[model samples]
Target: MRIAVALFEDAEELDWAGPWEVLAAWARQFPEDDVEVVTVASHDGPVTCAKGLRVLPDHTWETLGAVDVLVYPGGVGTRRELADPVVLDRLRTLHAEETLLASVCTGSLVFAAAGLLDGRPATTWWGLVERLGELGDGVDVRPDARFVDDGDVVTAAGVSAGIDMALHLVARLHSVERAREVRRYIQYDPEPPV
Candidate 1:
């Protein structure tokens, strides 16, 4: 399975990195699973993230082949992507090809703008739930969900939530045991101190 994580300028750091950590760990731990995880950008140049972290993508959109799954991260940059015809068309094509589409935070906004989330059950950053509903017709916005898995399209709520979504992807694609192993390997026992 080939999983491509889309990166762009001003993308939230944790939104993509969290999922990358989980999915990449799965690929590393289970080489026999034939899982390949890669970071992709619209261009070949370095992408400056929302927090100013520069990331060199593994591939550009033009260079990427058929992807089994696509993880679109969200941030302020997604605002521009929402109106990008090229990005929207690419997403539409991917959807038509039956590629599993996943989004974190405001990434769902782009999907909504691309008409991918119309009449679909989806969620995004808590603050943008209403905005998501406004963008797509009949988008069942789940304000409380950390992530909603709707078969081909999965939408994650916020930054750290992508980790949960990614682990869920591992379990869904492979096995519960394999997902557990990956989680253990990553030592992702979250205990948020309040």
Candidate 2:
């Protein structure tokens, strides 16, 4: 399984890191499964996160391979990146490839900007629900869901919610038992935010 986690200038750190940890742990725990996780960006270079963590990409968008799971995380950069034709074009291309796409926080904004969520129910980083209304009419926009699974697309509410989303994926892909084992390994026992 080839998973590509897209990054950008000012990308939310946890949006990528939280899920990255889960998937990476999966590959490490189950070495028999070939899960190659790679970080990608629009260009091949260093990207500094909104939190100040600088990361280097394994590949650029143009050279990416067939991604089984394509994750686009959000941050302050999204408000601007969502408007870039190149970014939206790449996202639309990835969506057309029939690959599973996921997002965290305002990451859905990118999907919305790409017109993927135009008529589909979706959610985002809470407060913006009213503002993200362009995603079609009466879209549930369940801001309360820790994460919503709408077939090939999965969306998490906020930053930390991504952890739960990743765990759910583990349960879905392998087994609930495996997911539990992962949660236990990570000390993320079943508990919601306080």
Q: Identify the candidate with maximal TM-score.
A: 1
Per-candidate TM equals 0.99, 0.92
Minimum summed lDDT over a 10-residue window in model 1 is located at 114-123
lDDT of 1 by residue, 1-194 (tens): 99999999999999999999999999988899999999999888899999999999999998999999999999999999999999999999999999999999999999999998889899999888999999998999998999999999999999999999999999999989999999999999999998
lDDT values, one for every candidate? 0.96, 0.83
RMSD of 2: 1.8
Candidate 2: minimum summed lDDT over ten consecutive residues — where? Answer: 131-140
Candidate 1 stretches with Cα past 4 Å from truth are none
**Model 2: per-residue Cα lDDT over 72-186, one tens digit each:** 8888989888889999898888888888889888888888878777667787888677656665454568877888888888888878888888888888877888888878777
Report the C-alpha displacement of residue 48, candidate 1, in angstroms.
Answer: 0.1
Return the lDDT, model 1, position 157.
Answer: 95
Backbone N/Cα/C clashes per model: 0, 0
